[model samples]
Target: MTRKLTPKEAAQRYLREREPDVARATLYNHRSLLKQWWQWCESQDIEYVNDIDGFDLAYFRLDRQMEVGEVTLYNQMTVLRVFTRWLQSRGLVANGLADGMVVAQPDDASRNTKIDSITAQQILSYLEKYEYPSLRHVVFAFLWHTGMRLGALRAIDLKDFHPKEHYVELHHRPETGTPLKNKEYSEREVNLALWCCSILDDYIEGRRHDVTDNYDRTPLFTTEQGRVSHSNVRDHINQITRPCDYTRECPHDREITNCEATTRLHAARCPSSIAPHDLRRSSVTYLLDEGHRKELVADRVDLSVRTMEEHYDKRSEAEKRKLRRDEFGMDG
Candidate 1:
């Protein structure tokens, strides 16, 4: 007979067991996503994992669906499904409980939101002219050019970069606190363009903080304290991606000086500002639209081609048709 486990106990155990196997960010997200379910369990007075059934899972999904968007609900359900399956493996929950949970399907509009090439170029041009070699410039440029996930970008060390070879090797080093999303599978060499390499070199030589993290690893991106936190990287992206910040023209027709989003803390509130993931999606779509092969772009960005096509490819039908026509010389 299996021992009884409270919902909280099961969640803590699952997260603890998963910590070593996943990246710090991934583990943290899992914890956060599951925390809601655990809280719901407590509210419903469902004390033990054994008490969770198919109806309970359905009700929880309904409750959360009312509170979040389809994409967020999907993510929550996916994580909860995994948690349910894990509990079943431990004999804490009934078998097939996970099978009963339905993951939400996001609409095309939700999946298709991304920065376009023109806007991306504008941001890059502004950075190149004014903020070249600065932390904001380096981070934004690296994300746009490489399309690597923020976690992977943050995990770079001074030693991992090779200005001479024009590539950086990504390693899975969870013991040292920076693990890739796919762990060992995600480790690969990302090549840099000459322009990107030049900017990175300037930053390292002139502006980079040159500080070692707590693990004694010298991060390519850092502050006086150590390795930059994920939130800090996200904030930098938000701040720089604001249209007014680079363009000095507010498309929203608001007075720039009086706009709340002009402040560093509230930059994300800007209607035109985008998140780091938007940069990644934009980069992937830009590479594909530029005629790069799906497999090659997939390798560069560390994403499966299917995921790229389904989620990241925001190119319009007309644009895709034009590419095909140009490829076949049908334009003549």
Candidate 2:
């Protein structure tokens, strides 16, 4: 008979013995899921480690599928599979419960669906009509134009911007708390467009008033309280797009009308339907449309050619029509 270890004990041991190089955030997420698994086992009156088999794993995954999206359920299954293998290696469990786990794959039709890309004209319109403080406006403008991922944007410090060199060096300094998803060697320099530099110049000038001390280490983007986080940037974007109430005269001319007006006037006015990542996609699309080589664009944007083609190479209906017309000489 195989020795039995309690779920809690196994989890604690696994965590203590796991790879030290694993990110703290990733470990925390695993711990959270394991705790939930243990809690479910207790509630079900099941022997957590000893009784869990392929069937039990399948049922747990089915329960997760009912509550979560396909992608999340798949991720959960992956985590559980890794944990079960670890448990088996440690001799805490007789069976690897993940042997027969089934995870639903995302639909092919849904996988290729694309988000609306921000256009240069739309971005210009947004900037012209936005009424936010200068720094916020600058960040919005920069994101729309450069299509930098939020992670890279947040990692930028004042020294990262080199106006004289016409490029920004994205250094690998995880020790400074700016973690890159792709690790150190993946860090590369990005050439700043003239427009992007002009926006930065305006932002820096506006930011000087808010800085009492000459701290060059200060982040390129700051919050109202002079500190910023990834979530704070998301919140700012959300706050910028919220609808406002405006009163208008009733067409009947009998009474005044109060209507909630939601305008997509600028970056602040962009439809809340779009996300930050979509801006990067839009940039890639624009670059491709302008005849930039796929490999060159991918290198500049820090993406693989496969990723660029798979996600950002979407063409709009109008563009598609134009392409056909051009090829067939419809205008002749």
Candidate 3:
């Protein structure tokens, strides 16, 4: 006889069992990805894991594709597949249920659109003037100035920060639930600009919530309950980047009354809204455009030089030519 387990219960047990085997960062990602699945199950009234079938999985895929990029959609399904297999092993789901779930092949297409330096500055200036010392303001400033990944940003703790020195250290602590993407290799001290540090100080002193995560560690960013969630971080970025939020006008000329993107949940649907990863890419390109050495940029961003040039560098050929001309004194 098969054991009965609610979808949520199975997910919790899976995560608990998998924690010791996987990197903390990976486990966090798995949890974040599976979260959508468990929510979907609740919406569909899937009382038990055994109630899930191939058709339910297919519909879940369709629902997710509407909300996330193809790459993200692919990752979500992959995690769901792994979880389903685990459930089957425990007799909570049917045999071959995991095999029946179809996973889409993710295309590694390059995203060319990014928030350029001018736009980034405009957004930051708006946040500074209007939302100063708030979580949204601090998050935008850190991502733009430091060019760190979302994982790295959330991994930051109060103890890792050194405002007096204008730098923060990144550490790998899997046991504590905050781990860098590349494990120990991703650890480094990132210097903050004086202005950035000033805002961070104000945020920590005045506006930040006094809370500790499950591990009893004080995160730099937090909600009233505890540390800020990954989805919340992404949502804050999405909401702030909407042109209407800062500029008070839509570039697409869509009426706010009829526009769905104006809503908080659908903010990313706006054409003018920028994703967090694109902001990081733009930061890398901006540094490179300013004639910073690629080696230094690579070290700061925790990426290889080759990867930075091939993937992160969004400079056009004409822009590259202009920079080269200026460097070689070809500009008359």
After the best TM-score superposition of candidate 2, give how far the Cα of residue 199 lies from its true spot, in angstroms.
3.8
For residue 202, model 1's alpha carbon misses the true position, in angstroms, by 0.7
Which stretches of model 3 miss by more than 4 angstroms? 1-23, 42-54, 65-113
Give candidate 1's error at residue 203 in angstroms. Answer: 0.3
Using TM-score as the measure, name the better of candidate 1 and candidate 2: 1
Q: Write the per-residue lDDT of candidate 1 for residues 1-332, one digit (tens) a residue.
A: 87888888889999999987876777877898888888999999998888889999999999986655455567778888999999989888788888877786766342324678898889989998998888999999999999999999989999999999999999999889898988899999999999999999999999999789999999999888999878788789888888898899988888999988788877766766667888899899999899889999999998888988899888899999999888888954
Residue-level lDDT tens digits of model 2 in 1-332: 56777888777777877647686446755887788777777766776586777777777777766544444456677888888988777666655455666756655343222233443454444554663236556666666656677677767777788987878777655676666656675488888878778767766776533431123356767655543565555444433333221122222223222221132222222223234565567677877766667798888778889988888888777885786677668994
Clashing pairs in 3: none
Q: Local error of candidate 2 at 66, Å?
A: 12
Please give the RMSD to the true structure for each candidate, in Å: 5.3, 8.3, 3.8
TM-score of each: 0.73, 0.57, 0.81
Considering summed lDDT, which 10 consecutive residues are worst modelled in model 1? 104-113
| Best model per lDDT | 3
